[model samples]
Target: WRRKNENNNDDPDPIPCIALALALLYYFRLPTNEDNVQRNDRSTPSREEFGDVLSKYIPGFVEIIQNELEQFVNTDHFVIPHG
Candidate 1:
């Protein structure tokens, strides 16, 4: 499904859509102050805790990144045209 972007009148890109989906997942996982209050665990998640949670959700994320990197390297001429 594609939605028109209000700013450019173009269909939304998949990259940003994926990023937004991941952001939503992280936002829910990392609870807010109100959520902490309800759970009665005031201490926030540590760096390791955050990494563990992210790793759980995105097991294939690293593979995806590696594949993209490989594709980029295989390209003969990697260049972005200036607008």
Candidate 2:
């Protein structure tokens, strides 16, 4: 993929996008409130709010993401081949 991108003068890679997505998911899963104080700043949306926004853009986003993750984990991509 890198070679192809380099040959075409395209951007380096899409790994950052995947990393950002995973980071966002992890952030949302954290509790919004801790010890009666907001865990995040006012600008940051809560998990429910983020989910609502995602659902508006992609209907059934949660289910779709969950299904895709499950599929990936069960596929050979997640496996380390024996030597």
Candidate 3:
């Protein structure tokens, strides 16, 4: 994707990119607080709620991330052999 856009030198539409990036980040359990002072605001959606909202735009996103995580954990990079 980067290489395809590199020569054109045109900035891509930021709104969708940012939205998708946020969705992906949220999927990975990362906090994306818009307001630090009101970070604990009750109106804010819970993690599951946030995921639900993202799911509307990104189908099967949660499952994909979870599967990737499982794969990582099962990989040798994440596993340690005790002597």
Best by lDDT: 3
State every prediction's TM-score relative to the real structure: 0.34, 0.39, 0.44
lDDT (C-alpha) at residue 61 in model 1? 46
Error of 2 at 55 (Å): 0.4
Alpha carbon deviation, residue 42, candidate 1 (Å) = 2.6
lDDT of 1 by residue, 12-58 (tens): 64543453455447634676566667788858863345545655666
Cα deviation of 77 in candidate 2 (Å)? 2.4
> Candidate 3, after superposition: displacement of residue 51 in Å?
1.0
Better-scoring candidate (lDDT), 2 or 3: 3
Q: Which has the higher TM-score value, candidate number 1 or candidate number 2? A: 2
Q: Candidate 2 lDDT, tens digit per residue, 1-83?
A: 12224345665644433433743666346445352254446665565555556666656655655655565556467665656
What lDDT, from 0 to 1, does candidate 2 have? 0.52
List lDDT for all candidates, in order: 0.53, 0.52, 0.54
Q: On lDDT, who's better, 1 or 2?
A: 1
Candidates, ranked, TM-score: 3, 2, 1
Any runs in candidate 2 off by more than 4 Å, and if so which?
Answer: 1-43, 80-83
